[model samples]
Target: MVHKGNCHTQAVCAVATHLPARIHVILKEDRAYELRDLEGRPISKKDAKALIQREYTVPEEIRQRTRGHKKRRRRKEGYIRSQIRGLVTALQASRFA
Candidate 1:
């Protein structure tokens, strides 16, 4: 049984085997980049920009429409963000430890 939260883990892990030993980082709400490892540890920003520049895939941008009467978009955006956060948390967990 797969949980919705860790959906990204399956994808990330599957690709991990094929990917080179590259560092993974995520953009935080504060517009800062942080290491996306098993501990959410901090890393030097010196090489972080290079990684971003070399990224192959870019995530789609999301925005809420203030003029829309329907709230579906807002709810969907929230749900997507929640799922992403859950995936990050799952990735940070130590399987061996």
Candidate 2:
């Protein structure tokens, strides 16, 4: 988790690793947690310090949309699997009938 001021914000970035060294570096990197301006360029040490001190909150709409997309994807995959299973069962029943 990234600690900002008094709040311990959970890391939202998807990281697929269990190695302690890599995890340490990722958590320690402040740039990953900072909300970048539209330009999306690397800033100097002075600028980075200023950005960290500022409080920011992600919009609720974005958080909800992200959750919706994930649920939709899982539902689609489940639908496809059920369709295939039903087809196989129907084929077996027709052959034995």
Candidate 3:
């Protein structure tokens, strides 16, 4: 189960039991429980918060987009080929010149 108290205080606790072998494991992991980030580097809470904000925070414009909305059109194969041909011609011209 996931228990979230505040933005900075979130924990995931799992209770596992093996009846046959009589094995029980109680795991309680929290974001702030460890003073290290996913990369295993030591980081302060403020630094962690800043890193999370920089990576996970979404832009307001993207957030306002409707679900299932087509934001961009896919490039056609012909268009891509033409662009590549143009680039190749330009490169050749530059090389010859």
Ordered from best to worst TM-score, the candidate numbers read 2, 3, 1
In candidate 1, how many Å is residue 81 off?
0.4
For model 1, the stretches where C-alpha displacement exceeds 4 angstroms are 1-70
Candidate maximizing TM-score: 2
Model 1 score (lDDT): 0.52
Candidate 2 on 1-97: residue-level lDDT in tens? 2222222233432233445666577688843634344377767777766765553444456566556877999999999999999999999999999
lDDT of 2 at 4: 28
Clash list (residue pairs), candidate 3: none
Candidate 2 similarity to native, TM-score: 0.40
The TM-score obtained by model 1 is 0.27
- Candidate 3 lDDT by residue in tens digits, 1-97: 1122222222111222333232222133322334557788989999899877776565445444522243332345567889999999999999999
Q: Which ten-residue region of model 2 has the weakest summed lDDT?
A: 1-10
Global lDDT of each model?
A: 0.52, 0.61, 0.53
Lowest summed lDDT window (length 10), candidate 1: 58-67
Q: Show pairs that collide, candidate 1.
A: none
